[model samples]
Target chain A: MADDQICPKCGAPLPADVAPGHCPKCLMQVGFESQDQAVADPAEAPTAVSGHSGVTWDLDQLASLFPELEIIKQVGIGGMGVVYQARQKQLDRFVAVKLVRPDLCDDPTFSERFTREARAMARLSHPAIINVFDFGQREQFYFFIMEFVDGTNLRQLMQSEGLDATQALAVVPQICEALQYAHDEGIVHRDIKPENILVDTKGRIKIADFGLAKLINPEATDFTLTGAKQVMGTPHYMAPEQLERPLEVDHRADIYSLGVVIYEMLTGELPLGRFSSPSEKVQIDVRLDEVVLRALQKEPEKRYQQVSGIKTDIEAVSASPTGHSPRQSVVPPTVRQAFNNLQYPGYGLYCVVNC
Target chain B: MDDAGFPSPHSGRFATTRWSIVQAAGVQATPNSRHALEELCATYWYPLYAYVRRRGYQADDAQDLTQSFVLSLLERNAVQRADPDRGRFRSFLLGSLNKFLSDETRKQGAQKRGGDRKILSINVDDVENRYQLEPTDDITPEAVFERRWALTVLDAALTRLQGDYERVGKLPLFEALRGHIGADKSTIPNREVAESLSMQEGAVKVAAHRLRQEYRDALRAEIAQTVTNSKELDDELTGLFQTLSGT
Candidate 1:
């Protein structure tokens, strides 16, 4: 009878005939699967078919391939490849073995690039980063032996017991430390989402899959491989430049993604299409909104120049007491100076004394 | 599997749906089984009517054909031919209807056969009025049936949710928060609703989230009734979403 109204959730035009008061598409999607299951669509991440021989490997076959380790079982399957938990015979410890998808290795120069990037990843040694033990091409399979994280990922944590403002505050700084460490080593983690961030039982954050994005898909310009329906990285966490001008994306893109992760952790929602500030959505310090908003800035130049800056700002906010009014005069010049001094390791301690 | 004859393992909310009851009854139609089928037919008759109309039938002829087909299905034990293993009610209905339509010998005789036996209480004017608003895109009759079926399923689920809220005397709250059924609550203005209902903003957010969870369970329950088991429920839902979004 009238022009069709648009659905706010999915942006699809609601059918004119059926006035169900809710978006029919989204409603059908709700019936499709629970929120958690839909996020990891099985179609996108198929079970791994090991090697280029088109033969699916059983545990025995996988164990035979890697004689040095006891192949436990398949732990995870991503667009990149499969991850298997195994114990190194010589080292007598658990390690995650990541196999590069055989299809990805079809590129002629893949071996050279993989070796180069894998070395860089191996060189990165930080508590907040998953340690890369060994990487090499074993037969047709390019594998990476990494430190196994014996805990759930950030995505699972957020889905199960949603993070409160306090828990989110603690998690952000650790992510910043890990990201900053990798960034300084001249390796940019093109894909930095909650799924890649692992949290152990002791509540320690470890960022995984550093430089693997570049190693998998060398051309950053082709962000989403829509032809294969294989998303390189979660688009919601991607910076504007990653989607628009992918070639120019630098370490700041990782900062933008970290901003998205922080916002999602705080509010349990993606900051999509004129979203409200995190403080407005949840009970948090109002000043922390500035840090989130700046990191989420559309232009790369406007965001935090370094990943450590996000940590400094978050730490500064955590150091101060809550319920303080948002006034420029409230933050003393000493605290403002601490903001400029990005490399100050004890900025939070300094803020506690001064402001 | 037991003295009851119906599968016993399917317990709790999924124990005995109308389709499952009819499937369990097989060719022998008991009174209880017959009543369950009738109730299901009444709820889902519109999609069949829409499908008939989309297949190039005129208003009066399409109405007669759908009614006659449904009558034959109810009275003649036609569901006996529906494969017991393929337990999806939607697929069985579509297949049986197609078979009935394709039989030229029975088609002419079945038309205007059940003029006095109107078991379903479907409003003719209202049904045609809704059909007129159907998109005139170049979609097949099967696609039309599927999309209409998906809408009908969601409508039934929403109506059930509304009825639940109504019984608890929370219809006003349901009305205010219905728009957020499948939406992210954070993106919506909970404070506005909170002030209007004189509720704490946090309490309103919790209420909204609970409503969404309830709505999801209701929709799942509705879908669960159509398929044979819990496993097929997700597959059926995925199919419904694809059908609706494809158009």
Candidate 2:
């Protein structure tokens, strides 16, 4: 029963000294030599701010804010605050710190919403969601420490290597799980795009930035209400209901965003972007087109009732003969052919289309 | 990855007590189905203990109150009363413990009677270890209890893996291998590890592979026990990492 004595292939008992882990007979039958090779030595040790030199900061001061970490350098930025590569002193781990832009921190409403949303996100304990450890305000800067995911975002991934069905299949389950957890917790992730989805070194998806989530049953009254509605979130992936009525919308909005993601993954082009005519652009596979179309329906009632239902549809499409091919309904055949012609540079096409 | 024997963490992992009662419906169900009751008791032990101790009881008096509470539960087969469809275990356990604490308080010397047997097989040493680990000024006994619960789960997971390793005589190597996963990225000079173990570097690689596989199995098994369904395994595993790393 010793771990070393067990054959990895057959799970059969073997003596420690003689057991080679792989079933010897199986190996012989397959003419396989146990290469036992190291998979491409993990991407060169992640360096500090090597990718984020544009932004600047006072290292000593930022380090004080995160008393538990050794702030190495400022990394990058997007619509969100500046990112930093810092080493967590206590855990001897490296983490990414996202500091809210100074101007946004000054807005009391934004600050409250941020804290509440962050707490909601924290409650969402899922593999696909990047873990958020602590959030605090220090010296006029509000920051949150997150698991420093090593690897690129889906945007980066798709840009270099347009997602093949295999890569897309790998992440679909992870995203569904994260969304399911968030939805179950009654928090609707308003934004779901490639940029917000991170892929760690192990190829696990990590959804980031639940900054716009609104709790279904909030403990306190609305802190940032503007005439009973809060206008927020990205537009491209926004559900139709989100555009027509922001506050009243529920988890179906996220399902719509996920549909956009699925569409981009398959067609290598967005379904709802500026096109001469939506149908004329891509080769929309039938079932996928219907799912995406239903998700984007202007009315919340018309969309998938639960994120889990969308997951089931995605799973079915993935299992079917078409294998995640963009159904022809939304993606016109001509556009699908063009998308197929465009080779994934290195990261993937889905990343570029969504990014 | 497999689901047949695996427990589902969501639908019935904690099994809201109310569901069991509705299912039982005036008949005694099997004992193994009583996990919902055990889990509720285990998670809320300290909250109940704090309520008892605060009611002005000596250590033994508090112990007796706890015992009677558990004994009353065993005698009544209270789990059968748990209707997960109608109520949460949190409210039920709190209500039950509160009544037990109040009745024991009125009796004055309830410590001398029918509740002396140990109801909970808790490791007091582990509890103290957790208490000591907390910041001295910031922690209260209640907080210590919560920490102990978290630590208990970690201990269980580790112990489960260690036992599996031991069964295969790979325990010693596992001890050495555990550090490889999350250690700081300091250079380890393979030659040093090889020399210290009196093994060749090639052999060390082989050992590392075996170690990683065992660790994965151990980690998976640890995650499996907490969740009833295989689908939740990844989420639970992530939770474990986040809990350990304080992420």
Highest DockQ, which number? 1
Per-residue CA lDDT of model 2 for A1-355, tens digit only, reads 3534644444444333222332322222221111111111111101011111122344555666668887754444443355776778888887888775554444447566667777877787787888898887776667788888755567555653457655575677678888888888887777787778877645678898774334221321332342212233444566655545555667887887887777677667665433222233444335555566665555678778877777687678667745333323446565445434433221232222223
Relative to the true structure, candidate 2 reaches a TM of 0.43
Model 2, B73-109: lDDT tens digits are: 6556765555454343434555566556556453444
Candidate 2 wrong stretches, greater than 4 Å: A1-56, A109-111, A213-231, A273-285, A322-355, B1-247
Docking tier of model 2: it is incorrect
- Model 1 agreement with the true structure over B54-166: per-residue lDDT tens digits: 99999887888888888888898787999877789999998998998888766787885865567788788789998998888898899999999999998898888898777
lDDT of 1: 0.74
* DockQ scores for all predicted structures: 0.14, 0.01
Instruction: Note the clash tally of each candidate.
Output: 0, 43
The candidate 2 chain A region of ten consecutive residues with least summed lDDT is A40-49
lDDT of each: 0.74, 0.52
> Per candidate, chain B TM-score?
0.91, 0.56
